[model samples]
Target: MKLYPIEAGNFKLDGGAMFGVVPKTIWNKTNPADSNNLIDIAARCLLIEDGNRLILIDTGMGDKQSEKFFGYYSLWGDHSIEKSLARHGFSKDDITDVFMTHLHFDHCGGSIQWNKDKTGYEPAFKNAKFWTNENHWEWATKPNAREKASFLQENLLPMQESGQLHFIQNPDSDFQQSSELGFGIYYVNGHTEKMMIPYINYNGKTIAYAADLIPTAGHIPVNYVMGYDTRPLLTMPEKNKFLTDALQKDFYIVLEHDAHNQIITVEQTERGIRLKETFTCDDIF
Candidate 1:
């Protein structure tokens, strides 16, 4: 099995919104904000080449939204999905599975793209079977007002329309049940709802994809929950449990939103679980 980091693109978001109640005085040190108080974030996706299956973990925000709509996020950086894939000697058609952690635009937008004449949306990975949880699908499709903007129809509906959408909830499914997942599914409802964090068994090491649960390394602080969370209170317990387990198991947490650091390890300190070390994913190899 081979895993590669795919750099889809980057975008800017309000630092305050990303860090919730965490004071700017704290988070700003690590994720320095621009004059507009926006923090640059990476839409880093993971590609897994396991035998005959080429699975892509997430798709960055695609270039289908109107300029006016994209004006809000301020997408930046030169890294693109196509360029990143080419570097790995692959293309969208080579992806057999597109495993979405959730249906948020930044995470799944690249899964679908606008047709040539702007007639309609189409699957970005023509040969990939789009994978998502049943619970998250319903939550994104009939999103509440708070999360409606993040779950755009243009980025989601096309997966099902193309007859390539599949849910991963069957008990017989071993994606999460096998030791290959490293730590297995640690589903938490605090972030959005049933956000699936993949705990990968890479060689002798254990790494976890810390989706929005811990957006950045600065967010390692227990209280730095995102305001975008549906239930911030619930996030605390979930994070505490996750951190405890991660620290106990000596796991490398792969941050999906952090621009500078790609992976982080935790340690048990007087202040509870704190970052032990930081490094790029390639350093592990």
Candidate 2:
């Protein structure tokens, strides 16, 4: 299987929000903030070419949102979904699977786009089967006040409306049951209801798509949980266990939101699981 890093675009978010309880003094060292105190982040997506099935992990925040709405996030960078796809000699129509880790706007917003006439929204990947667990679909569709802003109805609903949406978890299994997305799915709830981290088997190495679970290499510290997480307390155990397993197995972590660092390998340092090395996706592949 071949994996490509799809650079959708970049955007800015409040430094405080990204780091959660971690003070600005601390997070700023790693992610320096601009004069406005917003930290730049990448909506980097992953493309999997496994046989004929071309699966895309997350769609970066699409360009369909109004300028006013986008201004709120301070979107930046030259990388775009279309340009990035074309860079790799592909296009939206080439994708066969849209495996969303969750339905948060930045992760799945690119799933739908505005029609030419601006009459209505349409699925960005018309031929791709948009994949998300049934439990997550319900959780996001009827979002609570805490997460309502992140779960935009326009980004979702259209997948189901397009008759291309499908659930991953078996009906008999618990909503949190671990499953596979062609690549194995490691289900965790700390970030949201049921975020599926894909463990992709590629090039004789196990590369995990660290979706929010480890937003960036800086979040390797166990206490660096995002306040956006519905259950930060539950996140501690999940992070600890995942990090331990990753180090023991020598897994390469493919970060989705990290702006600068694309992949990081962890090791059991004297201080605990610290980053052992950092490299680009091309370096590993």
Candidate 3:
């Protein structure tokens, strides 16, 4: 199996929102903010090429939103999914599966795109089966007031409309291996209901896609949870358990939202789980 780091694009989010309750004096040291107090955010997606299947994890926010809509996020950077795919000599059509960690716009927005006629939306990966759990599918589709803004209908619905959406059954178990995808789905609810973090076995190492649960190396500390999380109190314990297991099992974390640091490992320090080492996908894989 081969893994490629796909750079969808970059945007800026409020640093305060990214690191909830964590003082700017602390988080700013790792993820420095701009003059507007916005921190750099990456829509980093992962592409796995195994035998006949090319699975993509998390399609970054697509370029379908209006300029006014995108201005809210302060979108930046020229890196795109097409350019990144071409770098690996592949295209959207080659993707057989799109494993969404969650339905947040930044994470799964790129799953659909505007059709050629500009009449309606269509599945961006024409040949890929979009993978999401039943719980999350419902949670996103019938979003609560707090998370309604993040779960855009344009980013979803089209996959189901195109008859390419598939739900991972019974995703309540922790680290349950999906028979078809051949990856362990680590379910966490603090960030969102049933966010499926894919754990892949590669080269004698377990590489975990650290979706929003552990978005960046800076978020290694259990307390450094995102304010956007629906339940901040629940996030603390969930992060603690995940970090403890990650340290014990020697799992490499593949960061999805960290713009600068791509992958990281944690150590059980006296203070708590802390960042051990940071590296790129090429350095390790």
Candidate 4:
């Protein structure tokens, strides 16, 4: 199997929101904020090419959103999904599967696009099957007031309407050991209703497409949960488990939202799990 880091784009998010209740003095040390208190963020999606299946982990914040909508996030950088894929000698049409970590606007927004004439939306990858769990599909489609803004209909619905949306019919448990997609899935609900984190064993090393579970390196602390999470209290225990597993198993934790750090590994320090090392996609793929 071959893997590639897909740089969808970069944007800035409020450091306060990203670190939840963590003091700016602490989080700011690791994720230094800009003059506007915004920290760097990356929509660093992952691409896995195994046999005939070319799976895209997430699409990042697509370019379809209105200017004002993007302005709210302080979008920056020239990196885009199309340009990133082309760099890997591929394109949207080459993707056979779009396995979204979740349906949040930033993660799945690139899965769709506006139709010609801007009258409606359509699946961005015409030939790819959009993947999401049944539980998350419902939660995102009928979102709660707390997360309604993140679950944009324009970023979803189009895939289902295009007859390409499919729910993984795995066992209703925390982990799906084996799935048709040729990977293991851990279903956690702390961040949202049901966020599926994919783990792929490539050459004996496990790579966790962490999504928002571990948004950035600075968020490695169990208590450094995102303020945006609907259940911040529950996120602590869930995050602790992921961090412990990464430490024990030596998993490469992919920081989907970390701007500078694409991948990382943690070590069990006296203070608890801490960033052990950082790696770029070139080092792995």
Candidate 5:
């Protein structure tokens, strides 16, 4: 199996929102803010080439939104899914599965695109089966008032309309082997309802797709939970358990939202679990 880090694009978000109640004096040291106080955000996705299946995890926010709509997020950068795929000699059509960690726009917006006629939306990955869990599918589709803005209809529905949407059965435990994808799925609810984090066994090492649960190395501190999380209180214990397990198992964390740092490992520190080392995806495989 081969894994590729796909750079979808970059955007800026309010540092305060990203760091939640964490003081700027603390978070700014790691994730510095711009003059406007927006921090750099990456829509980093992961591509898995395992035998006949090429599975993509998280499609970054697509380019279908209006300029006014995009201005809100301050989207930046030239890196795109097409360009990133081409770098690995692959294309959208080559993707057989799109495993979404959650349905937030920055994570799964690239799942759909405007059709050629500009009449309606269509699945961006024509040949890929869009994979999401049943609980998240329902949560996103029937979003609560707080998260409604992040779950856009244009980014979803089209996958089902195109008949490429599939749901992973709820695992009986925290981690379950995904026989079809050759990885173990870890479910965490603090970030969002039933967000799936993939625990990949590759080359005698375990790589955990941190998703929003542990977005960046800076988020290694259990208290650094995102304000966007549906249940902030629940995030702490969830993160603690995951980090403890990750340290014990020596898992390489594949960061999805960290613009600069791609992967990292954590160690038990006096303060708490802290970052041990940082490296790129290629450093491992």
Candidate 6:
């Protein structure tokens, strides 16, 4: 199987919000903020070319949102899924599977787009089957007040409406050795309900698509949970356990939201699991 790190786009977000209660005095050391207190963020999506199935994990924030809506996030960059795919000699139609870790706007927004007539939205990738778990679908569709903003109806609904939406079967354990998608999936609820982290074996190395579960290497510290997480208390334990397992299993964690530090491996230290090494997709795949 071949792997590609698709640069869907880049934007800036409040460092405080990204790091949660962790004071900027601390997080700023690693994820330094700009004068406006905004830090660089990347919508680093992943593309998997396994046989004929070209699977894309997380679609990033699409360009469909209004300028006023996007201004809230400080959108910046020339990157887009279309441009990124072309960089690797592919296009939207080439994708066969879109495996979203969750339905948060930034992760799955690119899955749908404004139709040619502009009367309504439609599935962005015409040939791809959008994938998410049934539990997550329900959670996102019927979002709570705290998360309502992240789950936009225009970004969703269209995929299901297009008849191309599919769900991976839920497993008894939070961690699944292998799903029908042919990879290990680690399901966790702290970030959102039933977010799936794919443990893909590419060229004999395990690549864990650590979405919001461990957004950045800076979040390696168990308590460095994002402010956006529904259950920060639950996130602490879930993150700690995931980090411990990552060090033991030697998983190359792909940070979906980390703008600069894309992939990293963990090492057990006296302070608990910490980043052992950082790598770009080119260095690993």
* Candidate 6: residue pairs that collide: none
Report the error of model 4 at residue 271, Å.
0.6
**lDDT of candidates 1 onward, in order:** 0.85, 0.88, 0.91, 0.91, 0.91, 0.91
Give the C-alpha miss distance for residue 141 in model 6, angstroms: 0.7
lDDT of 2 by residue, 52-115 (tens): 9889999989999898999898877789989988988999999999999999999999999998
Question: Residue 148 in candidate 5 has what lDDT?
Answer: 97
| C-alpha TM-score for every candidate | 0.95, 0.96, 0.98, 0.98, 0.98, 0.98
Evaluate model 5: give its lDDT. 0.91
lDDT of 5 by residue, 185-209 (tens): 9899998899999998888999899
Residues 1-285, candidate 6: write the lDDT tens digits: 999999999999889999999999999999999999999999999999989989999999998999999998898879999999999999999999999999999999999999999999999999999989999999999999999999999988999999999989878998886555788898999999999999898877899989999887788899898999999999898888788888888989999888889999999888888989999999999
Residue-level lDDT for 253 in candidate 5: 93
Comparison by TM-score, 2 against 6, better one: 6
Superposition TM-score, candidate 1 onto the true structure = 0.95
Q: Is candidate 4 or 5 superior in lDDT?
A: 5
What stretches of model 2 exceed 4 Å from their correct place?
171-180
Candidate 1 local lDDT, 1-285, one digit each (tens): 777889989889999999988889988998899999999899888887888888888898988888998899888879888999999899999999888888898999999998889899899999988988788899999999999989999888889989999987643332355332223666788989888888877788877888888988988878889989999999988888889889889988888899889989999888878889998978864
Note the clash tally of each candidate.
0, 0, 0, 0, 0, 0
RMSD of 2: 1.9
Q: Give the per-residue lDDT digits (tens) of candidate 3, residues 1-285.
A: 999999999999999999999999999999999999999998899999999999999989999999998999998889999999999999999999999999999999899999999999999999999999888999999999999999999888998989999988785466698987999988888999888888899999999898999887788888888999998898888888888889999999999889999999988778977989999989977
